[model samples]
Target: MMHNVSHVRFFFLSGFNETVNFKVALFSLTFMSYCVVVLVNVALIVIIILDKNMHEPMYILLCTFCMNGLYGTTSFYPKMLWDLLSPIHVISYSECIVQALVMYSFACCDLSILSVMAYDRYVAICRPLKYHSIMSKQRVLLLACFSWLTPFSISAINIILTSRLKLCSPYIDRLFCMNWVIVKLACFPTETIVNNIVSYVTIIIYLFHGLFIVWSYMYVIKTCVNSLENRAKFMQTCVPHLTSLLIFLITALFSVFNTLFGSTLPPTIQNVIAIELLIISPMMNPLVYGFKLTLIRNRILGGITLQMK
Candidate 1:
């Protein structure tokens, strides 16, 4: 018998059961990792904001990217750290929904921002004379808003639809709440038809976001091939964006495939796959950009030298 949706007050997270013996070690490592993530992302954001020269379109988009990384990781790490210490691994229904909203929106916004970054680069290299006019501060602001709001709205709709279902169980088998996992807990298959439809539509929409990035890069690379100047520009600006995109795609795809098909895998391996995006992408993106971008690297090293003096 399916339970009443109104009575579903909390969810038991079953992923932590196996970690009870090593929770302390896990907590210390996780806490340290979260600290490093925050430190590096914030350092980049601060570098971008403090230097007037860093206020260009590429840096602004990078700041937004790091901000999004912080936002995404914040949703996962605090609760995870708390759960590591607490014996009962449960979350209130409303809290679970909120977590799902932030987590999915964060992921979607990542792809959207990356797409915008690709467009920004394309305009910079392929259409050099029109670059400033096209990627003006006002236009970039508009694009940034679109990147964030569109994904949040789409994620919110999915979460709202999932929230309507009468769930058959309150046990979430993973470490964190996910929109699809919640939908899967619905009492009736017929009730989830709309949910499945909307889910596919949302996936298709982001699939296009991925395609747009590819299209933008194709034009970018072709333009960069002939001119030494454009190739230099590409090495300086576009490489970091490409690296970040590759990291995001790899980690995001791992999580997606693991979610869809890793049921038979060992729980430890499954857990690693699920959290890969959260841990690897968030931590690596800032480091990749910080070290790769010349201006940012000089500013950081200059500051370090000044402090050492």
Candidate 2:
């Protein structure tokens, strides 16, 4: 079979910044974010894995959060930071497709995991009498498996579909190869593909995930209102999740707006917001749970020291 990979030469990037100072600022911010992300996410994963006390479903879900954060960091950071430091900001055509796939694939996976977490919380709370039976170890394992595998299948589908397309030029509008930008570069007329992606993005990525999270929270809240003891513990657990979902939701919603409306927001302002969103998870996630939340810090420390012995 003849390989149809585009014989494209140069991949032109409408990189994040144009001016020297803007580039410098971006470099400083992204570097700091990458470091924080690596340190905190790894620490969270280790803490949860080492601590026997942290082996419950809630904490296990939190551990998956750290892993997802790690995936998120790797998906976007290294190549982007390299571009910031270097003068020539070009990615090979093949590299662009790979990067786009990695970024979106991880993003979709994160959504799946978050949805599982939301449902987990709902089961644990709303169905208290049956909670143990409903969220047994076997069930948790099943949910986890589904969460990781489902998006992976979709990502594979997308990669296979995209790999079949032909390309005339490699000029992409975004700093990186966003799905929107890549689809825009298709040589052939792409109404069906574009519409499919946009509709899927709007419905599944935005609407489905968004609605599920909110619905889960509603059930959680109803359950909480009907309960009496352990109210504070419930609050503690809910707050971190709420914070994570909000950050993710706001960024996704903004991205949708920018794509649909052609954000009149200046590029400087937009890039700044985008950079902050990209890096904020590193600091926010750990601080929200371990540093501020109860039992986590001391338990994590104790768990680490015990492991060393």
Candidate 3:
């Protein structure tokens, strides 16, 4: 009889190895953060769904964005909370891959959704006469689906390629499973050429997303410069979107650059950078949108007051 064994069936996450002394504190903070993330995101999602006035393209896109934030954070925080409680910090191979998929898809989809939001704002501010026709509910739904499905498909391809490699090590130095980190574990460096190509391509694709956002904002800024009404609209609406985008890109690029170059930093700092996107974006998106967009804010206040009554 012949036996076929897996090369690596699990990965040991070393991100928290040195920080175990603060496990209780870390768990407390993470759990509280996770609760806030869920509550805020879900609240926004529900408010958008229930309010007919907010059924516009911008709010709908914001709703999808929050949903994606929730999706991504759920993938990390639960397992992370568990690992924080456990002495052994390990993840099964399949679970790791799925986590990587969820994370990448969530992030890429976020950029995609943001791009759509940028377009929505551009149309509203720049081409108001055609905004309704261009961003109809059907069109909005299509764009939202495209934003989500395209990233998921891209991430699935990357994970599929990763699954075929024969891993040289079972240890991951980070707090969670990232696709690039998994690629680095391949037994032979030559085997990862395709993965690298795919990753760069993915990066370039999202880089264009960033460019779209920049170009959109440039035109928006230029348009708002001369008109007081446009300026008020910009401050009232577009600022939140831009803030979310800024936070997202900064945290995401920090992680990517740190992973590729920040070898000299302590593991604690690296861990902080690695999880910054998950921590900051999920919490910030809803708060920014919830407070900045008045309709949703009033709806929430109304709901709370009714509850109090």
Give the top-scoring candidate (lDDT): 1
lDDT of 2 by residue, 52-168 (tens): 877777778778777777876786788888888878778886787777676666667667777887887777667768877887778877777777777766676666566566667
All candidates' TM-scores? 0.97, 0.86, 0.96
RMSD, one per candidate, in order: 1.8, 3.2, 2.0
TM-score of model number 1: 0.97
**Residue ranges of candidate 1 with Cα displaced over 4 Å:** 1-4
User: Candidate 1's residue-wise lDDT over 1-309, tens digit each?
Assistant: 344354678999999987899999999999999999999999999999999998999999999999999999999999999999999999999999999999999999999999999999999999999989999999999999999999999999999988888987889988999998898888889989998899899999999999999999999999989999999999988998999999989988888888789898898888888888899988999998889888999988999999999
lDDT, candidate 1, residue 278?
90
Clashing pairs in 3: none
Please list the residue runs of candidate 2 whose C-alpha ends up more than 4 Å from where it truly belongs after superposition: 1-4, 16-19, 191-202, 273-277, 300-309
Best-fitting candidate, measured by TM-score?
1
Candidate 2: C-alpha lDDT: 0.71
Query: Taking the tens digit of each residue's C-alpha lDDT, what string does model 3 give over 150-201?
Result: 9999999998888888887999999899998898888888878899899999
Quantify all predictions' global Cα lDDT against the true fold.
0.92, 0.71, 0.91
TM-score of decoy 3: 0.96
